[model samples]
Target: MDRQAEFVLRTIEERDIRFVRLWFTDVLGTLKSVAVAPAELEGAFAEGIGFDGSAIEGFTRVYESDMLAKPDPSTFAILPWRSEGPGVARLFCDIQMPDGSPSYADPRFVLKRTLTKAADLGFTFYTHPEVEFYLFKGQPEAGEIPTPVDTYGYFDNTPHGMARDFRRQAITMLEQMGISVEFSHHEGGPGQQEIDLRYADA
Candidate 1:
């Protein structure tokens, strides 16, 4: 086994990780996941865990449903939210065909292919996402906008701002998983917030 794969195995045993979640995305860009016991990880890294691609939107037809999810050890991280009981870790997977070829339908494969092309042209792609969202009091009724949780504006720092506390918790969890947050603050609209993630290679 390679060094990274060996490291993952060692960590799982050392941390008493009971479940390892394999993450991937379907063609429509929706995240998908499957969990496996620790004992099955070695085999998963060697060969892959199989699943029915046909069940996933835009993946494949029922007649050719077999697909493999090969976990990428480099992306392994213990899920901070799943800290109770035996710990749960996660790894992003690369999708493959039954014969071990990279599946064209895999969104990760598409991104990697594009990145390779960009590299060949002496360019690199990076992304710094400024995620914005709204917080409402409750579900909105038909043709009615839900009430804002707070009437705060851009960078408003108040003692009772729920968004401030939410951002702190979010950034903490993100950092625990090795993701960096550049910064975050309230936005212009009421109950609107923005969080900027540090730029990273796409």
Candidate 2:
């Protein structure tokens, strides 16, 4: 086993981690996860865990549904939200076929392939994404638009801005996961908010 994999095993045992969630995304970029017991991790690192890909959107058809999720040790991190009981950790996985080949339908594999091609061409790909979202007062009725939490505009700063507190909490959690945020602020629309992520190699 590699040094990273060994390190992961040691950490799991020391932390008393009970569940390890293997994470991946479908072609549509929807996050998917499957949890495994800590005892099965060594085998998972060796051969990967199998699942039926046909159930996921944009994956293989029912006939060729068998897929493997090989966890990437480098992306392992303890989930901060689950602070009670035995700890829960997560690892981003690389999807593979039954024959141990990279699946073309895997979004992470496609991105990695693109990054490799870019490196071969003497270019480094980087991205700084500005994510925007709206805050609704509550869940709306069927077909009815929800009301905005506030009438805040661009860069608006209020002493009692709920959006401000939300952003602060979000950034804190993201940092705990080793993700860096460039900045965040209110957008021009009512209850709209924006967060700019730090530029990183894609």
Candidate 3:
């Protein structure tokens, strides 16, 4: 095991971790989870836990329904996004068949496979998402026109402005969780703003 993996296993034991949550995404990149108690973790590390593959979207057909979720220890991290406890930690899993081969339909696996190919060619994939959204006065009704919440231009700081305050709060939370923010600015459309996240290699 590498130093990081060793540290995670040691921390989990020393910290009295009660649950280890395995996470993965579907073909459409929707997150899914399964929680296993600390007692079963070692077995999970060896032989993966099984579930009904047909139930999950795009996993398997009804005739052959068994699938497995094998956790990759390296992805273990405390879920700062959640406030649950016995304190939850998450690991990304590789979906597998009952006989132990990787399931091609897993979206996480697809990303890993693509990254692996990139690695073989001496390249890496880096994504920097610029998320843009708008805030309106209230939910728009059927055929009801939407109006801008504020009239502030790019980088204009007005005291107690709703749009400015909301974006600041969101960026603060993102930074607290170790996400780096490059910039935040008002977009061309009214009440619309954009937050650009800094890029990093996985």
Candidate 4:
């Protein structure tokens, strides 16, 4: 087995991991997930887990729906916010055909193919996403706009607000997932947050 895969197996066994979530993105960049039990992880690492590709956005047609999700052991991380018990972890996956060929419809494969071209040209590419999301006070009714969780303006250091707590929790979780967060702050819009991310090639 590959070292990363072996490491994952060891970690799961030693940590008493119960669930392992396989994560991947569809062609339109929508994230998809499937959870596997720890007992099935070794087989999954060897042969991949089967799923219906036709159901995923832009993945495959109904006629050619058979697919495999091969976990990328290198992307393994424990989900920090999961309830304390048998640990829950996640690994990003690369979609593949039943015959073990890389799936063209997989977003991760598309990005890797583009990166290979950049590599051939003596260029390395990196991405730092400035992600933004919102917090609302309550669920919206039909055709009704949801209220902001807080009225705090940009970087106001609001005292004891839901937005502030949300940001703090999100940052902490991101860090635990091995993502380097540069900083987080309130955006100009109410209840919106901006998080600057940084990833440098070592």
Per-model TM-score versus the true fold: 0.92, 0.93, 0.73, 0.93
- Taking every candidate in turn, the Cα RMSD to the unseen true structure, in Å, is 2.1, 1.6, 3.7, 1.7
Q: What is the lDDT of candidate 4?
A: 0.89
Query: Candidates ranked by lDDT, best first?
Result: 1, 2, 4, 3
- Candidate 1: where is the Cα deviation over 4 Å? 138-146
- Clash tally for model 1: 0
Which of the two, 1 or 3, has more TM-score?
Answer: 1
**At residue 74, what lDDT does model 3 achieve?**
74
* TM-score of model 3 vs. true structure: 0.73
> What C-alpha lDDT, on a 0 to 100 scale, does residue 10 get in candidate 2?
99
lDDT of 4 by residue, 58-174 (tens): 989999999999999999999989858779999999899999999998888988899899899998988878999888988899999899887777787876878878888989999
* lDDT at 86, model 4: 75
The global Cα lDDT (0 to 1) of model 3 is 0.81
lDDT of each: 0.92, 0.92, 0.81, 0.89
**Model 4 TM-score, 2 decimals:** 0.93
Q: What tens-digit string does per-residue lDDT give for candidate 1 at 147-187? A: 98899899888567677888888899999999999999889
> By lDDT, who's the top model here?
1
Evaluated at residue 110, the lDDT of candidate 4 is: 87
